[model samples]
Target: MLSPMQLSKKIQGNDSSQRINYLYQISKKVVEKNPVLSAYYGNLAVSVAKKNVLKIHPDIKRQLCKKCRCMLIDKKSAKVKIKNKKKTKYIQVTCNTCKMTKYFPANKGNNHRLWLENPEAIVEIVN
Candidate 1:
């Protein structure tokens, strides 16, 4: 069976809606059981899309952000916090144009401590 990454590339310039649907189905199953792998497939799709864009225009890459699909930037500050004290981690990504926040892993362990070590981008909580 071809992986979702492979399916992503094959469907890009083709008239194969059926094949694309198949890949999307596979992605749905993978998401329900294994989230990390789902992220990998998503990254692959983004990478393929990026490469296709670069192949066509070549200049759009200079103005786009890889992670957020927003305007390009030399640097970005990402913030992390635990919301509600129930170990629910949240990510606050401040791009030049958008200040976006999202909740992530429900049970982050020592990785949550990184929020403390890096204070420049990460906000520290005192509770």
Candidate 2:
């Protein structure tokens, strides 16, 4: 088995795909036990990807808090709210750990694309 330093070096030297995957796994595994550590790992992952000029996957990126870099799990680590103003709708995500809020447009056109609206887009992962 590799030592912690060697393991981290191996992860850092990997290609973008593998590195991001490792980061995601690490964040997910630690978020429940220690959110601060998870956030640190998440920030490290984002910085590494940015430094390498790689694209962080949208699915993974969306799950992380923009301000605290913490994993956002609704009712667990974050609070999610949907708001409507005038003719526009937006979803607000608040990071419970840091009290930071992020917003995302809920409608783009005639159709709404909120994750709950589409059945196919929702998948229950048994892991």
lDDT of each: 0.38, 0.71
Top-TM-score structure, candidate number: 2
Q: What's the TM-score of each model vs. the native?
A: 0.29, 0.72
The list of candidate 1 runs beyond 4 A from truth reads 1-24, 54-127
Model 1: per-residue Cα lDDT over 34-115, one tens digit each:
5345444434434555454523122232222335434222232233444554545553333343344444443355554443
Tell me which residue pairs clash in candidate 1.
Answer: none
lDDT tens digits, residues 16-106, model 2?
6667667766665677778898798789879888988987776677778998898776667778887897777877888878999988877
Clashing pairs in 2: none
What range of 10 consecutive residues in model 2 has the weakest lDDT sum?
Answer: 118-127
* Ten-residue region with minimum lDDT total, candidate 1: 118-127
Per-residue error (Å), model 1, residue 56? 15
lDDT of 2 at 79: 84
Candidate 2 ranges beyond 4 A from true positions: 1-10, 107-127
